[model samples]
Target: MSLRAILLITLQQEPGTGYDILQRFKAGLAHVWQASHQQLYRELDRMRGDGLLTCETVPQAERPDRKVYHLTAAGGEALDTWLAEPLAAGPVREPLFAKFFAWERWPADARRRELGDLHEQLTQRLATYAAIEEEWFAAPERLTPAQRAPWHTLRLGQRLTQTWREWIEEVLEEGE
Candidate 1:
């Protein structure tokens, strides 16, 4: 999906400043869609120009004005239409799989080292996701109705990470 659609969905959840949206990505959506601050800011500007969003500057004391964005009617309709469309399967583009395909060319020691490194990285990521999950469950009362979909996505991320970790462990045990 385009970043525009993501941004619009975010705004549909609630109006927010650019920074607020960035925080939302870091807090939860990073597990699914990764975007840099530059990309988000650029897309926000483009969305504004496209009349998909309306921005209002909120004055601040001792700081620059904050431009809060809201989804326009057109934006909401666009998001709804996009949501209703059938999804096509995107091509797989996993770097780890690509690296594994080239593993035979590496020395045996290098192959072991690569697998060890992969295991470590996956472990760390799973830890991070676990912490986010814990935080979510810690405050069930604070979660808005809008969070249900992202919560489901978070569960998928957790499951995918767990599956990858288990597969890596199996490979390591098999001396592959």
Candidate 2:
């Protein structure tokens, strides 16, 4: 989903600021949608201008004023409509898979090093997915069934990483 769409989904829960949206990205959407702070802020502005969100300036005691965003009625309607539609399927564009596909030209040592690095990265990623899965199971009610896109995306990441790790193990064993 687009950043604005994700922001709309979040605003459905409560009015929130740009920083809050960024926090959500770091806390939950780090895997599914890799958006920079700049990208999110820019999208927020565009979404507000397009009448999808309403912004309110909230005064802070020690910090600068924060602009809280809420989804407009139109935004809610849009989100509901989009959620009811079918999602597009795309090819898996994994960097490690691409690297492995072109590995025939690399020296044996280089291939071994690449596989080692991939294994390390996948191991860490698996840990991340496991943590998210725990959190998802802990409070299943906080998120709507249809709005669990980030968690669903995390599951996909888990499967992909696990498969790659298994393949890496096989490759390393064959090279022995």
Candidate 3:
């Protein structure tokens, strides 16, 4: 999916300033789609030009005017159209898988180190998800209708991470 589509869904979820949108990506959507600072700002402007979004300038006391993006009617329609279409299966571009393929070339010690590093990264991600759950989703039953989708996505992330971690542990144990 294009950054434009993600931006549309984001604004549709809750309109906010550019910084607010960036924070949303960092907090949640970054897990699904990654975008650079420049990509986001440029896309927001392009979306505005395309009439998919409207911007409102709010003056601050000492800061530059904050531009808040609101989804236009066209943007909503675009998002709806995009949602209705079936997504094609994307290629698995995992570099770790490539490392697995090249396992014979790397020394055994180096392989262990790589596996250890991956395990550490996955553990850290799980910890981050746990933190997010504790901070925002302590009580899933109380989530608003709008929050349900995100909550489910978080659960999915946790499950996927656990599965990956388990697989890594199995591989490491087998290698010993």
Candidate 4:
């Protein structure tokens, strides 16, 4: 999905300051999509120029003025259209897999260490998903069904991570 479409959906769901959108977007998909704050802010400007979103500047006594963005009617329509469209089918790309493809030169211990590191990272991600699960349960209706959306994405990540962990464990057990 284009970042523009994501931004539009977010604004349509709940209008907010650039900072608010930035944080929320990160929490939503940063683990997988990984957009920087700069990328989002810059896109916000571009969307504004294209009439997809509107900004209201609010003066603040304690800090710099804030620009909160809301999706225009056009933006909402655009998001709906994008949501209805079929998602593109693309090949999966994993840098680690690419590296490991030519990893015969790396020592066995080094490969094992890499696998251990990946396992640790996956454990941390599983913990993160547990935290999100708690929050979704606490506020049942604040967002879409966690099982249908973000949780689905998290599940994909967890499944892939666990699959790799299993493969690594098999390699170790077989004395590869």
Please name the candidate that would achieve the greatest lDDT relative to the true structure.
3
Off by over 4 Å in 3: none
Task: Report the candidate with higher lDDT, 1 versus 4.
Answer: 1
What digit string (tens of lDDT, one per residue) describes model 2 on residues 1-176?
67777888778888889889888776787777778888888988998899889999999899999999989998999889888988899777777677666677767898899899989998998998788778764565688876576667787889988998999999999993
Best by TM-score: 3
lDDT by residue for model 4 (1-176), tens: 77898788678778898789777766666545656788888999999999999999999999999999989998888888998899878777777777667777878888788877887777787777667657654454565764357766766776876787788677668766
Off by over 4 Å in 2: 136-154
Residue 114's lDDT in candidate 4? 84
Give the poorly placed runs of model 4, Cα more than 4 Å off.
30-32, 138-149
Residue clash pairs of candidate 2: none
- Among all windows of 10 consecutive residues in model 2, the one with the lowest summed lDDT is 132-141
Give RMSD to native, each candidate: 2.6, 3.1, 2.0, 3.0
Better model by TM-score, 1 or 3?
3
Model 2, global lDDT: 0.83
Shift in Å, residue 135, candidate 4? 1.7
Best of the two (2, 3) by lDDT: 3
